[model samples]
Target: MRTAATLGPRRRPVALMSFVAAATAMVFGVAGCGSSDPAPGADLSPAATTAAEVVTVRDPWVKAADKGMTAAFGTLVNSSRADVTVVSASTSVSPMELHEMTMKDGKMVMQPKAGGIVIKANSEHVLQPGGDHLMLMNVASPVKAGDELTFTLTFADGKSVQFSAIAKPFTGAGESYDPGHPSMSPGMSMSPST
Candidate 1:
């Protein structure tokens, strides 16, 4: 797994003054992102206060080996002084859910847990095939290996995190990241381009 951070241009630096002032008091501060409707710099509900726990989540990637079913995996990080719970997720897909890929009845299955996965304060979780992941059902288009997907995460406190993914299949894909997703894989992985 590799990690990198790239900050984008601030869309609203002025409107955020008040929010920033409040967040600064709590010791958490983040340049607001998401939503074209937010005032100059209006933040996504949970302002960054030191006690506010800031988080950065990467959208899940559907392994190239995906067939009728597959999973998109990524990471979530709480970069704040406090802790938080990721309440929900909002994406282009409907009934957007947080699902887990684990061994059930001794067979690898991607099932939805009771509540959304918890992203601990200052902690991280990896949503990968054969593990915790976001299940994309009936993918509208075929995403070949090397394609990308964009998604957003809605936190319990109402904060939003956005990220994208580059598609890749599991090792030998037929089994490693298989989620039996129904719309993801067909027991095939792309051939290597030599």
Candidate 2:
């Protein structure tokens, strides 16, 4: 993926992970609408398997961009199966691609990933900004607080899981490890982990 040199004047991407390569992966995206209602046919049943595990994406959120661009972050995990390929993703925007941001040749570039990301059945992948972030090109509208969006993950094995994530104001922070974000610094205090 190709990423912009600076997500903003204050936030610098620090997360390290690839959006492509087809071997263990992650993806993040913006909220199409605000989060409040429930998804149709929401299923929390355990997937029958030889091993005890839950397949899901963890902590997904979108970071606001000043220039009508927004980035997504989250974690992908497969605790039961070792062969899972993310076929595709659907969002409010008709066009969405798995992207990664990094300092390449002294510039930030964001680009679409080749093929798709493959996750080993029992491992996890991180989708962090400045690295493997989901970019919503030509944002439909100005997403703000109280807005929720829907994202569906399609697996290679014909399984589609729909999850809803809300858009949080981007104060320079990008998910869990955006140290260069405007909200953090060496002199700043770190909140205790719950």
Model 2: per-residue lDDT, tens digit, 1-194? Answer: 53676454654344423334223322222233437544768643433332213457789887543334566678887776455667667787434566655455555555555566666667887877556656564456766645677887776666677777777765643322223534233553221110
Instruction: For candidate 1, give the lDDT.
Output: 0.57
* TM-score, per-candidate, Cα-based: 0.55, 0.55
Please list the residue runs of candidate 1 whose C-alpha ends up more than 4 Å from where it truly belongs after superposition. Answer: 1-53, 58-60, 65-67, 93-95, 171-194
Q: How many backbone clashes does candidate 1 have?
A: 27
Worst 10 residues of 2 by lDDT: 21-30
The number of clashing residue pairs in each candidate reads: 27, 18
RMSD of 2: 29.6
The CA lDDT at 193 in model 2 is 13
- Candidate 1 per-residue lDDT over residues 105-177, each given as its tens digit: 6765455655677766567877764556675544455657898777777666666767787777566222333
- In candidate 1, how many Å is residue 52 off? 10
Given candidate 1, what's the lDDT at residue 72? 66
